[model samples]
Target: MTASAGVLDELDGIRWRERGSCAADPDGGWFEDLRAPAARRARSICAGCPVRRKCLAAALLYGEEFGIWGGLDSDQRHPLDEALRHGEPLGRVVDCALRADRAA
Candidate 1:
């Protein structure tokens, strides 16, 4: 795990239910509202989050196909996921993140 793995992996171990794992709302299609309403809420509560980078990297490294894989929501992160899952080069994905980060 990296220094910024996030809440999923914590002081003792993985807290899957409370962290990163998703909830399905019957009519809503997907996702349970586990995060704060604003991005700052996430960045504040999760900035020094032990698994922050790891969470983001996992979304990039593996083509996780649902929910908020990293701290980012689906729309915020789908491009990188698509690129990796389609066998696109890792560098392409990295570049995309860089470009996206700037836009953010």
Candidate 2:
């Protein structure tokens, strides 16, 4: 662990909305009304993750968006920007990015 179990403990907060509870969202995701804001908030939650660096690396490799992955998310970091900054490929966390303009 990079810091402590407490880091990831905050990750549970990422699931603010139930998977299939939202009637508006096809996926029934939580915080469907504020997806952009949710991503940022989730990044804050990631700041406490113990394996933040590793998680970020994994996210970068996978291209994970939304939620707190590696102390960041689609709202806090762009896919290409992440790859350029870390000089690595993100095909593991996210296969592709949904929005690049809103990237941090």
Candidate 3:
């Protein structure tokens, strides 16, 4: 198992239960839609998310292979996911993603 797997296991339930921008929405499933406008719509919601960092961290920690995360679509999340899988520290992954977000 990846180093993050165990840490992720212990944190998953609690982390997710913490409020996220989309959690209370009636359309929580929107984040998983891969279509063009749907991904865009989901990102809009994520953009204002108070828990965005936590959400992105969880996605990387667990290697989520689909959907929008932290206002980032699959393409945007790929590098962070790869870094996590390769044992990169979560702080470093988060820092990189934040930098990329600023540059975008």
Ranking by lDDT: 3, 1, 2
Candidate 2 lDDT (Cα, whole model)? 0.43
Return the lDDT, model 3, position 1. 89
Q: Tens digits of per-residue lDDT for model 1 on 1-104?
A: 75435322432333432453222212231344545354434433333344444456665655556644445556767777677678876555655664466466
C-alpha TM-scores of all predictions:
0.42, 0.36, 0.71
Name the best candidate (by TM-score): 3
Better of 1 and 3 by TM-score: 3
Alpha-carbon lDDT, every model: 0.49, 0.43, 0.72
Q: For all candidates, what are the clash counts?
A: 9, 15, 0
Off by over 4 Å in 3: 1-10, 14-18, 26-35
Where's the lowest-lDDT run of ten residues in candidate 3? 26-35
**lDDT score, residue 26, model 1?**
20
Compute the lDDT of residue 4 as modeled in candidate 3: 61
Better of 1 and 2 by lDDT: 1
Candidate of highest lDDT: 3
52-83, model 3: which lDDT tens digit per residue? 87777777766777777777767888877778
Q: Candidate 1 versus the native: TM-score?
A: 0.42
